[model samples]
Target: MVLKIALIGAGLIGREHAKLISSNPRVQLEAVADISEAGKVLADEYGTRYFFDVREMLDATKPDGVIIALPNAFHAEAAMACIERGIPSLVEKPVADTLEAAMQLTEAVERKGVPVLVGHQRRHSPDIAKARQLMNEGALGRLVAVNAMWLTDKPTNYFDAAWRRQPGGGPLLINLIHDIDCLRFICGEIESVMAFSSNEVRSFEVEDTASISVKFTNGALGTLLMSDTAVSPYNWDTAAGQALYFPHQPENTYVFAGTKASLALPLMDFWRHENENSHWQHPLLRQHITLDGSRAYENQLHHFLDVIEGKAEPIVSVRDGMLTLATILAITKAGKEGRIINVADMLG
Candidate 1:
C-alpha cells in the first residue's frame, strides 16, 4: 500500500524530505504547506498541492502521515496539530525551540497516543546503528573515552539569516547536537558538561567555535571541538558521506577509546591487541566492520512509514529528542557561564 505523506514547511530540510517522499515507492507526496514562494515552487515541481496555512492543508489533504520540517520555533506547534488530529508526524530535530516547548509537545503526544518520530536521521544510518549495537554488546569494551570533531568553514553569506547570528541558531544547537545525540545513543546519558565558546571569528552573537567536555553517566568521558569558521572535513556529515547535501570526504570523525580497543567511525576501524592476553606492548590489529551500502534518509523514510502503519516505534522519540536538546542547551549554557553545568539542571 502506498501511504500518503504531507509536508509542512518547504525550507532546506523540508525540500530534502519532499525529494525523499517523491522518490520512495511506498509513499505519495500528498501536499505541501509553506509560507514561502519556494514552497509553492517546490509543490509545483513535485506536482503536489500547496497551502499557505498549516491547518488548511491538513484539513484538505488528511494525509496518513505528515513530516514536520518547519523551523525550530514552529516544530512543537506543527507536531501538536498532527497529534490533535491523530496523525503521525516526523518532526525535524531539536524537537522544539526551548525546553518548555518540548515538554508541552511531549505531553500532548503522550496524551494523544500518536506516534511522532524525531528526525535525527543519524540514528537510522547503518554504521551509527551498528556502533550503538556493538557498544551495547561491549565490542568497544568499557567505553572509556570519546573524541569527536566537527570543523568546517561555512560560507560567510550563510549567516545572512538573522537567526543564524543568534544564540539558538549557532553550531552548538545546529550541528553538534547530532554528535551529542549519537554519543548518548551509543554510550549513555551525559551527567555534566563544561564548555567554552567563541564568536570572535565572526563576531556574531552566536558562537562560531566551541570546545566541550562531558562526563557520561557510565563513567566515560568525552571531548568535542566544533568550529564553523575552520576549513576542514572532520565532520560526520562529510566524513560518513551520509548527509544529503554534503560531498563525501571519507574520514574518521569520531573515535571511541575503550579499555580493550578503540573504534573510529565512518572508517569503522577497530584497533586492539592481536589477542586477549596481549597488552599495550603488543602490536595492534585493525579490523574494518563492514556496513550495508544503505542510505540514512532512505532508511528513515521507510522507518517513518513503518511507524505510520504501527509496525514499529520511532527510533528517536519526542522525549529522547528533547533530552538531546537539553544536553546541548546545557553545553551552550556552560560555554557562556564558564562553569560545569549538570545536564539535569537544563530540564529544571
Candidate 2:
C-alpha cells in the first residue's frame, strides 16, 4: 500500500522533499501546506492538493505521514501538530530554532507515542555507516583526534535573503550544524566545546567563519573550521557529491586519528603502519576503502517509510536532533563568551 505523505513548507528544501516523495512509488504526495504561493505551485506541479494552513491540510487530506521542512522557527509548531494528530513526521534539522522548543516537541512525541524523524541525512550515507562500523569494530583503534572542515564560498546573491544575513542564518547554524551532527553520529557525545567566530569578512550581523574545539565524552579531541567565504573544496557537500548543486571534489574533509590507524572521510583512506607496531619508526600504509555511492536523502526517505509502517525506528530521533542542536548552540555560546561550554549543562 502506498503511504500518503503531506509536506509542510515549499522552500528549497521542502521542494526537494516533495520531489523525493513524488518519485517514490511507495509514497504519494497527498497534499502540501505553505503560507506562500510556492506551496500551491508545487502542489499543482506534483498533482497534489494544497492548503495555506497546516491544520486545514491535516484535517482535509488526512495524510498517513507528514514531512515538515518549514523554517527553523516553525519546525516545532508543525511537528507538534503532526504528533497531536498521530501522524508520523520527518522534520528537517536543527529540529527547532531553540533548544527549549525542541525539548518540548520531543516530550510531546513521547507522550503521544508518535514516530518522528529528524533529517540528519548523513547518517544514511553508506560511507558514514561503514565508518561507524569500522570505528565500533576497532578498525580505527582508539579514536584520539579528529579534524573537520566546511569551507566554501557562497555567491553574493545567496545572501540576498534578509534572514541569511541575520544572527541565526550564518555558516554556524546553516552549515556547521550538519558537521556537528555527523561528528556526534560517528564518534560519540560531545562533552564540551570552545570556539571563536568572526564576521570580519562580510561584517554582517551573522558570523562568516568559526574555529571550534571539541571534547568528546569518550575522551577524544576534535577541531573544526567553518567558513562561508572560502573558495575551497574541504567540505562534505563538495567532497561527497551529495548535493548536485556543488561540483564534486576528490578530497576528504574529515580526518580521524586513532591509536592503531587514521582515516580520511569521503575519500575513505585508511592509514596505518605496515606492521602492527604503529610507531613513528614504521612505514605508514594507505588503504582506500571503497564505498557504494548511495544517496542519503533517498535512503532517509526509505527509512521514514519504514518508520511510518512500524518496521523501524527513526535513525535520527527528535531527542538526538536536540542533542546535536545543543552542541552547536554550545559552540556558538562558547564563541560569544570566549570560554568553554559544557554540552551536558547546556542541554539541561
Name the candidate that leads on lDDT.
Answer: 1
RMSD of each: 0.8, 1.1
TM-score of 1: 0.99
Q: Please report, as a residue range, the 10-residue window in candidate 2 with the lowest summed lDDT.
A: 241-250
Q: TM-scores across all candidates?
A: 0.99, 0.98
Estimate, for each residue in 1-348, the C-alpha lDDT of model 2 and write its tens digit.
999999999988999998898789999999999999999999999988989999989989889999998877788999999998899999988798899998999899888899999998889998788888889999888999999999999999998868789866778877899999999999999999999999999999989999999999999999999999999999999899886367888789999999999999999999998778559977899998988878888999999999999999999999999999999999989999999999998877
**For model 1, what is the alpha-carbon lDDT of residue 18?**
91
Native-vs-model 1 lDDT?
0.93
Task: Report the Cα lDDT for residue 129, model 2.
Answer: 88
lDDT of 1 by residue, 239-293 (tens): 9989999999999999999988999998899998877999988899999999998
**Per-candidate local distance difference test:** 0.93, 0.91
User: Top TM-score: which candidate number?
Assistant: 1
